[model samples]
Target: MPQADFYILPSADEDSRYQFLGKLATRAISAGHWLYIHTDSEHLAERISERLWQSSPESFLANSLPTEKLHAPILIGWQPDHIPNTPDMLVNLSTIFPSQTVEFSRIAEIVIQSDEILALTRGRFKEYQGAGIQPRMHDMRKRSS
Candidate 1:
């Protein structure tokens, strides 16, 4: 089973979620881990692609869409099957969890202050525990404040 990490953010908005992803992707890439950002839709994937590029003004994050060539270090897509199986890290940005999470060595699940997202994240945490994987929780608000 892959190690699961839940990132609880202070705000319950999509922008905050994307910001969290950008930082997480930067850290994972710096650690030499290929990142796969699985979004809920193609539009969301495109938005994330833009965010990744502008994530760091001084440094660029190599990223590409699913249909593009697989030369980038990070991939953004709505379909997990379309992503290469060799990625070391998986960042799920959607409310629905992917079934192929075990393929990656580490999975980051972001949670916000919204009730709906919070409820979904709680269920995902339980699912991970039921699968015998002990997931770690990180409250970003606590760390930032």
Candidate 2:
């Protein structure tokens, strides 16, 4: 069974989500896990790609889009079907649950403080629990302070 992690951010903004994602991706890669970041759109995918590149001065996360040979440790794409067959982790930034939910060993859902996002994430958590997977929640707001 795949485990789900919900990162609850304080602000109702995308910037915090992106920053946390960068940190999470770096940690996942350091732990030797190949990850795929499922974005809400192509523009978001591009933004994540850029953010990952400049995540930190010493840390380096190899990421690529769907095209032009995607053999990197991390991948960023809007469509779930575009992801390769062997990613160990899936970072979901979209509102909808991924179609290929069971394909990855672990999943991360970044949740902001917006009402819509909170509601969607709650549904996703219940869905995961219904599927017999235990979902963990991390309140990033408390950790940030």
Report the number of the highest-lDDT candidate: 2
When summed lDDT is taken over every stretch of 10 residues in candidate 2, the lowest stretch is: 79-88
Write out the backbone clash pairs for model 2.
Answer: none
TM-score of each: 0.92, 0.92
lDDT (tens digit, per residue) of candidate 2 on 1-145: 8988988989999798888888888788889888988878998888889888888888667789996485788888888677678768999888777878766899999999989999999898887887778999998889775
Top candidate by TM-score: 1
The regions of model 2 sitting more than 4 angstroms off are: none
Per-residue accuracy of model 1 over 1-145 as CA lDDT, tens digit each: 6888999999988799888887888888889889888888999888889888888768767799978875888988898576666757888877776777777889899888999988988888887787777999998898875
Root-mean-square deviation (CA) per prediction: 1.4, 1.5
Residue 144 miss distance in model 2 (angstroms)? 2.5
On the 0 to 100 scale, the lDDT of residue 24 in model 2 is 88
Question: What number of backbone clashes does candidate 1 have, counting pairs of residues 3 or more apart or in separate chains?
Answer: 0
